[model samples]
Target: MRMSIGRRLSLLIASQLILAALGIMTSIVAFRRLTHETAYLRHYVFEPFVVISSGIESSNALFDLLARPSSDVAYDARRPMMELRSFVEQYQRDWLTATSTLPEALHLRAALDRAGELGLLNEELAAVDTIAAVVASLERTTGLVGPAPTAPFLRRADVEDLGAALAKLNKINLRYMDVAYSAYDRNRRLILLAFLSVCLAGVAAASLFGLAVHRAIVPRVRRMVTAVQRFRELGTYEPLGDWGNDELAVLAHTLNTSFKAIAERDKDRDRFLAVAAHELKTPLTTMKGFSQVALNQRHDAAVRDRALAIIDRQATRLARLVQDLLWCARISGGERPFNPQAIDVQELARRVIGEIEPVASDHSIRLMPRGDAHILGDPELLEQALWSLLVQAVSVALEHEPVLMTIDADSAGRELITIEVRGGKDLPEDLDRLLEPFAVIAFEGRRGEPRGTGIGLHLVQGIARLHGARFSIERRPGDIMVFSLELRR
Candidate 1:
């Protein structure tokens, strides 16, 4: 589905935020696990070992008192025996409690089972109690304790046995510590691996997403910018393709549309200038030629008079061209003011025919009025339009082919004024293009080059538009062409 630019950006941002949130949640969970591991080691591993070590130290002291006792050592051994018993009891309670919390510590659990099988903590407590009983017996007064108990009460063998038992349990505790520490290390490593995995996955996902976003948006934006830059430098550009139904695509479409219009208008302006130059050059050439003749042939009054008249005629033609050009400019710029009034259609048609009659002596000009007609229009502009249309007709009409002008109402009995001029000559193959400015239809003339400014029909079209009239052209085989102008009455 096509998403708009705003929605797409929002989705991208939302995705990034979701990824970040996931990363943060992973971190929090990892940290929680790390904290739990820390507590597990303290309670299950380190603290239990502390209690076991203290018990072992006290047991060694107890063994010393029993094996070789001076009076001072004997007095101190009493305190050590009490401490050994208390330490052993504490170690037993804590070890069992700590083991319950660390179910996943496989080696630690195994070592705990081994300690229990060895009768480990029980043997240590038993030895401490037995030696206390022997010491109690040695201290009693039986006729002053039967010669002050000269031999050591507990034998070296018994002491050795107690030490061996203590040593065995110590070994078990050491093994348990090793297993617990290893478990802790593995736990740390697992947590670290998990954290790193989450981070790597998040980073990779973000990278892929970033690349996708860049591909979707950046290249399209770059293309539009490049197109605009090229247009700026050269006043021309190729259109951008539709990337999607996004804002940037719409922008690209709008720019292409505007540039196309500007290019077409530029083309029309160039064509107009060329045609205008040609029209001006022809009249200026004729005026220059006749003026020179009048100046050089001063002695001949007849020749000078004829040259002046010809010059005056050409000058008038140039003036009319200027007026038409100005009117075209005003209409195009929307500066031409409209003033409509009731006008006699027949009178205007007759005026156009009379004006063209002088130069159109070779071809007959006729006007057929079906009924008297009137229309609301700008009289001057309407008359100028009709004049241009008649002249254009006269230029293409064969000498023997009469140019006909008609004024009448259309089919619905609705009042309409129409002027139709037909010529024996054929129009250009592209009839529609012929309406464009500077478009001239090539037709052979019996005289010199056919007199056409190429601006007449274009100017006529503009004038028709200003008066809200319709202009059309029809042609038949053998180049029998007809031009029609329809106006509402």
Candidate 2:
């Protein structure tokens, strides 16, 4: 359905807003997922790794102290051993915290070879306590004698067993690191994929919207522009194609209607010019012939008088033609003044019939006055209108046929004065064309008669309109043609 411009714009904006909201929602969800993944990695993987690594460094320091003699040591080994034991305790506490925070469904089992090898996480803490006891015993032994025990004083088997325990703990920490890191890597990949997907979706949506807008608007604008250009250059444009209820479609319909009106006016102007030329040519030709004759026969008085009379007649015709043209112009421009008064329309009809009687010598003219044919109107304009119609009827009347002029009041409730000219001839099919200025009639009734300037009916119609009267023509039975004017009473 067709809609106004405002409605169409609203629809477009609403669609864009909805799309934008979707994009924003997608971005928010993706950002939240990324944030959660980052928090998980820091707590489960990175933070625990840092604590374990610190404990390992502290253990290495204690081992180095044991490898040296006690007399040569610059600092006491007891403090270093105590610090190492404190780090071990801290590592255990941090491991417990890390496990407590781990998700219910761990994604790290694939990274571990055997859960039993490490036992429970608490078992690992017990092994650290055993190492602390061994270190304490060694420290006591060092203080007792023999300038600190030699590096090989501890049994190879005992040292190897302690190293194996540390190795197992280290292996467990590394394996846990491997699992945490794997989970972190996978989380990173998923976040990246989601972000990329959102971006791709936003771009795709934008592209589709742009394409849709272009398709909807560009062609319509182009068609309108082309139509205007053609109208300017060639004075015509093709009819608009089907427009499916957009704002542009309504605009196209309006413009096309105006174009058609302009074309019709242009056609009318051309036809009027041709008809004017023809009307002027006939009188001018007659005047020229008579003037030539009068000039050439200067010696013959009778010939000159006859030529002058013919010239006078032609001049009168020319004058009337000019008068009709001027009246038409005045009426069309609304410059003609009308002064209306109460007048008996029957008397007006009598005056018009008397004026047209001489012109219709071959036909009988009659007046049929009925009722009180009274109307308030301009007497001169009404007379002119009646005269024009009577002359037209007489000109086209069949030989010996009667042209009747009637004046009467409307019998209907609407009080109106009607003037009708009923001619004894069949109405021509082209009545509308006949009413136009300078329209030529080619029917049997007009065959033997000389054509008038063709402005009579046009002028009559104009005068009738000026009097607020309706003018029309109709055919009745018995081959009667009636031209009528119904004036306001």
Candidate 3:
């Protein structure tokens, strides 16, 4: 099947939308993971390590008090000062190497400087030498009375300066951690929101695609199939039913056009058959009459009787053929007029069965009335449809074939009448077309069967419709053709 452009575009759009949805989902997950990692790196890693750097700096004052580079204090001080330098270097190196990005190294540098300026370095050598003089005075107290601690040289002012600088650096590092977490949280939320929006859009688009695909494909195929079935069974139908202006619409238009052309051509053919049947009927009747007159004067009894029988049989067959043709023409012309009325159902069934009684008896087929019923329709047309059904049934049942014909009406006092005709020999599968005026289908029959082209049922159906009746068919073991007249009341 050739897909419509709208369907192709919808598919393309749907595929793109699905991909976009997946992309959004991936982004949301990745962003969330990144944000979580950033939080961990800031608080668990950077924040803790920054505080470690501050601790490493604060420990420096102990080393400063021990470091006297001149006399006796140098030996004791050098060991402690060297240990402090190793500790600071190790912690700072760990902090620096653990992460390459972010401001850890910068914070470490500022922390080291603050630790140094806090009476641990000379202002003469940028505070280092001042710390040296204090260390020398404390270490060289060989003869001080009461050991007065060699006059304290590490001043409170130096400690205060280091403390203030450390506080400022710690605050800055705390702020950096806070900002990093805040930005991560914001970006994570953004990705999550975008994912939700994309999901909603995808769902809506999928629903629309489903509806559009259904509308574009299924109904047109159904309509065309239905029309063809009706045309095959009833020989005619209006095929340009309900459809839009898409390809489906174009298909319906083409179907209606083809059927219209077929009907027109059929009409022309029926006209010709009518003229031809009439022309043949006159000569056959005349020849039968002249031959019978000569048979009446014959002295040879056997010869004359055979000729007379042949003439009579030929004349009857010719008349029946002409009548069938005439009926087809009248039906095709839509000219089967009848008076409509509210009819008693029981009486209508009796009347139809009564009309077919002679033929049924002749063919040895039984006509059974099932129940009494009423309908609002033309009694004449209703009887005709039933009578046609019975006639077809009897004709088929003549070879000792058992048959059943039934009639009834629906409930609710709706005046809906029904007629069903059944035969012993299973009916032809295409028997539904038997009622179609110009649509003749052949069925197997016994020898000496009456010549017919399957037009009687067609005429009955046409007349029934002319008076507001519903025609329906069911093919069972034997064909069941039915007609129902809807109550006017």
Among these predicted structures, which one has the highest TM-score? 2
lDDT by residue for model 2 (150-182), tens: 442333343444555566666666666666566
Each candidate structure's TM-score, on Cα atoms with residue i matched to residue i, is: 0.55, 0.57, 0.38
Ranking by TM-score: 2, 1, 3
lDDT of 1: 0.67
Clash tally for model 2: 0
What is the C-alpha lDDT profile of model 3 across 10-52, one tens digit per residue? 6958766776868766787876777666655565447544554
Candidate 1, which segments miss by more than 4 Å at Cα? 1-275, 292-309, 411-427, 445-453
Q: After superposition, how far is residue 205 of candidate 1 from its true place, in Å?
A: 5.7
Query: Which stretch of 10 consecutive residues in model 1 shows the poorest summed lDDT?
Result: 136-145
Model 3 residue 280 CA deviation (Å) reads 15
Worst 10 residues of 2 by lDDT: 104-113
